[model samples]
Target: MSGETNRLLGMAKEIMAQPDGRELDMLASTGEQVSVALLAIALQALGKQAVSYAGWQVPIKTDSAFTKARIRSIDDAKVRKDLNAGKIVMITGFQGVDADGNITTLGRGGSDTSAVAVAAAIKAAECLIYTDVDGVYTTDPRVVSDARRLKTVTFEEMLEMASLGSKVLQIRSVEFAGNYKMPTRVLSSLTDPLTPLAEEAASGTLISFEEDKNMEQATITGIAFSRDEAKITVLGVPDRPGIAYQILGPVADANIEVDMIIQNQSVEGKTDFTFTVPRAEYAKAVEVLNSSVKAHIGAAAINGDTKVSKVSVVGVGMRSHVGIASQMFRTLSEEGVNIQMISTSEIKISVLIDEKYMELAVRALHKAFDLDSAK
Candidate 1:
């Protein structure tokens, strides 16, 4: 409660306004409402008239899902009326109203989504996302301090990074910006006012279309690592049509995501199948499969290991590149990184490696692909 009070006070100060005890108590939905109000006050202090509004006030209507609600529509008439009234409208980013007329909150960092949605609705020239970091880095700075910051990145690359584990931006926000062709700039909130918003500046990364003609699209963009993986192996199942479905249907019904499936050729009319799932759901997955499929298929047993990690190299450039997979395997092999399983998409090649080797594997791949260089 004290933390929330201090946050509201700080926001009020930034906006050059005295803290409103009543409004704070009634209107505060998330920390972002305070931020919007503060920003509005700052704009007002700069001689611009600004109006702060909450999600309920703006009435950003969304689905019934709380804490991850998808925006169904925005009552643009209300927004246009306010903007035309010479008011710089400030709105809470991640919260919305559901069909049941209930207030819903979009999950973590949904502010980015809110900002882009506003930009699209208002047809703004650009959307600027301010954050603590100057720009996206080649690798996490904490893990690789020398990781260089990228001046600019394409939407495809940004999406891949966000899905892979880059915390700089959210994936849905990027998708929204790209779909509308709304120019987006990511810059440090702490940077000096004189710093330009171009990719050449030490400001945040600019996510936009690439214009270079000779930039050799590499097979891999950057290495992404995740430790939330588990392996499930079903041994000695009868090899026949529809057997795979029989084994995986229940798992899917239970909403467990299965990744990197491998099935061996039939040996004496039986086959061993293996796949990966999120570690947190491994036990439920195993139990479901063992109970439902084991007796029917006369399989040997169900087994799993929750201590595995997944690392991948993602880049749309890989569509035209050859031998990238070979190079990646060779590099990891040189480092003695034992790969347990492998999977690939047209743009990404992922491998399951021991959790202990994650850092070394990423560093090795970073060097091998020359990712730290300013290519």
Candidate 2:
């Protein structure tokens, strides 16, 4: 798939000086269209009734964002009709039509978002996401040999993990499912589809509300880590009202995301502010700050480092537990790892660390929190 995209990108570069977003979406959407058509044909060859439909045919309406459209609404009239007629219907994913009828493709991994949106529109009982891994784990199994498969996880924990870098499901899809209270299962595509539903439930992890009594009770559900993080610090800024906004407003205006912001305790009348951004945007964010933001805000200097990563411990049980944060800090310190910045929410604690120690921090935290033994 990546090779095909690269080939198309090369062709576009050769054919046009600069391809517009609309044109790019139009070209990229053909990939999903072809996939659904081929899959439909394969099913028909097996003597089953199957049909393929494009996003416009089923009318998955989205905003006119071109390459990163958000689903505005989905009209299931044609889908329901086709299913009622005893035919298995397949629709192209990752592409939707705007109200203006222009072809728009969702961003990378938008197919997962499209599937979840459709399931919500139809009010399906459960949306099973079949992937290479059997289910969500205590940690990345490749990183930890004993990373156990979770039978069930609360939506809050799943959200934290997905956003922090578990990558089993798209973060937006998880948010959409949680909003509508949709049940999603992450199971292996290698399993037989004809298996009984009740028996198959044990093969994958179920993401449900915390109200589920069967959810495994644990202080820390998992440790998630993300690399390619860069830190930026603005030094000697007046510690007054709206100082944060003054420093970050330009980055936001330029569409650069800021994460894990921390302001040092005020010293005299000034303080130092620090934050992290994706490594790809680190240079751009620094340029924005150094160019004028520093002088305008009366800050002394700006500094940045691109060799950082974030580690987070997530669990719904943390809301009612004590000492989780201290335990996490102690575990990292005992492993000779240093925390660069810290951020926390009700159910999660995240810290920025040197990228080189990311694996060490995750492994130490996993064992410290007893995640390896979690059911």
Q: Which ten residues in a row have the lowest lDDT in candidate 2?
A: 210-219
TM-score of each: 0.81, 0.94
lDDT of 2: 0.86
> In terms of TM-score, how similar is model 2 to the real structure?
0.94
| Model 1 worst lDDT run, 10 consecutive residues | 19-28
- What shift in Å separates residue 64 of candidate 2 from its native position after superposition? 1.0
RMSD of each: 6.8, 2.1
CA lDDT, every model vs. true structure: 0.78, 0.86
lDDT digits (tens) for residues 137-242 of candidate 2: 8888888787888888888889988888899998988887898788888999888879987888667998975584633454577988888899999999999999
Model 2 root-mean-square deviation: 2.1
Q: Please report how far candidate 2 places residue 304 from its true position, in Å.
A: 1.7
